[model samples]
Target: MPLVNRDQKHYPGLAQTTNYNLSSFKAAEIITRDVVVIGGGSAGTYSAIAIKDKGKSVVFVEIKNRLRSRTETYKDPKSGRGIDIGVIVWYVTPRVGSEPNTTGAVFDLKTGRGLNAPPPNQTAIGIAFQIYTQQLLKYPELDAGMFLPDPAPDDLVMPFGQFASKYGIEAALPTMYSFGAGVGDILATPTVEVMRAWGLSLISSLQGGFLTTARHNNSELYGKAQTELLAAKSLLLRSRVVYTERSTSGVRLVVKTPTGNKLIKAKRLLITIPPKVEILKRFNLTTQETSVFKKFLNTGYYTSVVKNTGLPDTLSVTNFSPDSPYGIPKMPAVYTIGSSVYTPGLKLAFYGAPLTNVTSSLPAKTVKDAIIASIKRQQTANPANPTSFNQTTPTFAEYHSHAPFWLQAKAVDIKAGFYKKLYALQGIRSTFWTGGAWRAQDSSDIWRFTAEQVLPKVLKGL
Candidate 1:
């Protein structure tokens, strides 16, 4: 376990500039920042801000141009927003629920699961949510764009058809069940993992009725983040870190943009992308270590988003896909999303799942149509059975449209030693790691907890 000092990567911003000193060899474009954070998603960016606030210099880089995708906030043309298949957020406090709910922790004994904790109340995701909420509350600037109390849930229930019957919950969700996309196999996997996934889905698989902001869109937070980071020049949007090296001189980072590559030399690195084993192969971790990381990346993910049509208030909604009577996996032309939208505009974002084929890969449109077809079939089938319903039946709704990857599956073995190795990497190459894959599931929780847990350590190490 090698440790990277917090101050390991910072060189004072060059106050005195010297003219070109190129002598056949290029000097590492080394600028000293107390830390180098990678990825600009909620986790990476938030961690950078936390470090910066502590009076440490930091830089953040991301391959994406914007910190957020429209899919994260509003419904995209490609991906509709009926059901928020993404990790539906839920805030938890004793006040949100009745007696017996854990205040600091996310567990809600009444529902037999933690507040949105993945399968069997795994604490990571729930804790991340709690942490993120706490951070936002502390930093009024960040809290401006979010939904506070309405985001928290009182009873965390399992995902069964019972929602329709219980509490008479009427909410529409995207059919990420898209003809058994990882549903069966994931269910077939170990008990705990399946429980976590189901728990997240169950909580998010409802129609609208929760809280939202009054003015800005849900993604305003990302915008707010960009403004803060840009003023500091620590945020690099639309830039990709193509190569990183730990040289005797320092940690060299090559960030690529449309213009060209910019060399950023730092003392440390923090990686936030999903741990794709193949991508990790590019790291300079001796063949053996690189192979291990690549193996972790092999675990994989699936992407999806649903279409939400504003339904009347109090009108509960759910969706089903059609299939042949012979029992082949079927899909609906267009699936419903979120509880019938109380407001206008279509709400097309809900549930997502992992890649089931273990080797199956389809383009977004193909998958979208497949999902739509499955939902259509389910809608037409008898109330008792959707997949096994006769092909002759007609569907409840008919609209063929594209939807985003509501079910983006980032498969992880959690094989036990995975996080151990990741933590080990923290100071080794003078870098850090953050994102849902490391030790979280949603944006808020990961930001909050990581800010407290990782940032302080980063500052101290510096």
Candidate 2:
């Protein structure tokens, strides 16, 4: 890797702005690698591993103490059982492998009975899904990343509800809504965004094509990944980039860790973090990058494990609005409160809110309160057997905020080739980007995108 010098050219207007003198760092304080991967989530971890497999050196930096945000497993104190409050299911992929099929009961909260699709509706759903698949096939570029055409198609940019209605697939909205719980206001979302979230892999998962870890602990994969990176001495957890200097020749970063600051010089940088304006500003983003990133917005999605909930262990309660279109529940709502097969005494609740300026400001306590209140309201609404619904106060054992999730731009922006501009940012100043924002918000999809699309470009000169 080439080191930046005073005489070397840098990205215009972004040269040597940091207070730290580049030459003042001792050799011991400086670390050099072929690539530097930030944000130790699925994409970052996978990219680092892939780079190393190609016999290249890389450094992995993460703000969190651990890697992989979506696969969190909380152990019960008394029973020592692992409860997966985050990412309980994964699409069966060639790389990650699959597990035996498992089935769970879904009940309508209003009726307190099994939620089964009627035969006619089921037929309609099958036909609708076939049509939806056919439609998605027209845009094969979307399967990997945001490689849309120059002028985006109208059907793809329209609201998903309108798209469904136009295609006579409104019968599928209820199922899509249930599966796309964390996407927030799916019907209102653009068709392309909705397809990206609930794409082919997830559709396959709905047909018994998904898997969990053998122990039902999805975090196990990340644990193994951490072990590999630690063995290579290439991972820096609980670390953040304080400053960055990027140029056509290479990239340099000053990372703040627990012990001290370390200077990292690498041929390339891969950013897997959400490209929110506030987060990217720290990197000295170019004007063009800022203009593209500022339009990105995200929804609030949270998950938690609650105990002492009066719900039955065998039942999985899903929200259903009897009067709403396709029975889709309202926004800023608890999508489901259900028992997990791995955790007998506990229940997992998933709540999501639509995009808003204050979406990220909602306190975890408030979310927990809302979930419990929704549960109580559902219990009171069920008339089948009032005794079946207990009134015990539920306590949250574990909670995780997947906020700033499902990142996307407005439909108008997407139609105006926002993604084309976003993808064009790749390799700018030797920095590349990959994440749910750049691809589908799924672990398998992000991994595939990193491996197939971003990695090749990042490794080009290295």
Candidate 3:
């Protein structure tokens, strides 16, 4: 059992409510738990496990059958080996000695060969990196969450490109652009938003080294978590919240599971899902919460694994635009097409698009068409290339959407205390929040924030 917070004076309408009609779920089985965690992604999964470890009962709900969202593994039918297409690397603290020197070469589509040019100015890049990192260090809270000073510094709110020029870190723009992939138009993004994408942990990883799973399958981590949650009978896969009611005292939800609908009653509601108004409308959001969430904007990101790409396994193609600043390619475009490290003859393509509207979507066919066109353009640019897409069409083995990602607000809203109001929603109506949207968009960083900051507060309430 958990203690219910009875303080509802500050928030009116903090009483029983539901998005759907009560008569519809009269036969649903009622379930009770101390906490109900929605969206079994990185933050949700971690928080549920931590809550259970703290001697509290928790029920984890996920729309998908799997736990991890970004980490997707495509098993190659030929080799029977898992090829990690999403979230391939993670950062570890406390510098991990020296890393191997890796070389990158720009392949010329017109020439069908690697460009014979000098590498980027290492000295300039190093200096720019140092200055950029020092600037990020000034706001240490960004590593975990957006707990900025009341009056955020001008530098933090300014456009990242302006910040780069102001600090003479133009040499670092390309690097940042690469690191900030999936975040459309990094240079135009607010400085703080860019920092959230490429924050302190990533900087440390650059200085130290990145770690990947031994089996090259990042999903293994979540698989283990799923096993633990299943053993505790705290997980509900292939389930979605069809209706929810949150009051100051506690919360109740009607979840549509694969087996049947189940009514969940809990003292606290932890929503780790992306809090878009369209998604949260069913949660019976307060006027203030609705107003805050409606302002959030997010980018569209997708990943795919394909074969017969007409690209050599040795060649790595990076989208570039000489016209754009730092040669960053335009949005709604293919970011990269590279050979899979473990699976030869297979290529992975990453695509990113800017948010046009709240409901903007990028179709898989649209992405696949773009990739094919790009590959054909490359092969046609150089007729001498032996491989050609004239006969064979690239087969898309796997495609995953990571959209509604990199959630952020306009500069005006951020400066007008958007985060302050957003964070204030915690513990209100007996509901809490944590996820990439609430914190930095990194698994490790989100876990730290959930465990160290959010879970403590949640435990105290319980």
Best-matching candidate per lDDT:
2
List, residue by residue over 1-462, the lDDT tens digit for candidate 1. 111122221211211121222222234443457677776766786777777888888888776787753225434344343233333343342122111211222211112121332222334434433332343243232121111122222111222233222333212112223322333322223322222333332333322233433331446667788889889878777776544576433466655555544567666676766554433423445443554454442122233433332222222223332222211122322222333233333323222333332222345555455544543433343334422323332222322211211122222423333334445555555555666544434455566557755666566656
Better of 1 and 2 by TM-score: 2
Tens digits of per-residue lDDT for model 3, 1-462 = 121333222111233242344444444367789999998889998898889988999999988888989888889988887878887777774433321322344543323344454578999999999999889888987776888888988888898899999999999888888777877778788888888868878887888877777676889899999999999889999887766778988998877677776888899999999988777756878999989988899998889887887666655677776556776766877787777655777888888888544544677788778877777676666456564334346888888888878888888888998999999999988999999898877887888889877888787856
Q: How far is candidate 1 from the true structure (C-alpha RMSD, Å)?
A: 13.9
**Sort by lDDT, best first: what order?**
2, 3, 1
Worst 10 residues of 2 by lDDT: 5-14
lDDT of 2 by residue, 1-462 (tens): 123333322222233354556677788889999999998888898898999999999999988899977778888888786767776677774334432323454545544454564443688889999899888888888887777777998988898989999999988887888777777788889899998877767777777567666676788888999999989989999887767889999998877777677889999999998887666644778889989988888888889888887766656777776667777876887788877655666888898889753325468888998888867665565545644667678888899999878888789999888999999999999999999899977888898888899999999967
- Tell me the RMSD of model 2 versus the true structure: 4.9
**Per-candidate alpha-carbon RMSD to the true structure:** 13.9, 4.9, 5.7
TM, every model: 0.57, 0.90, 0.90
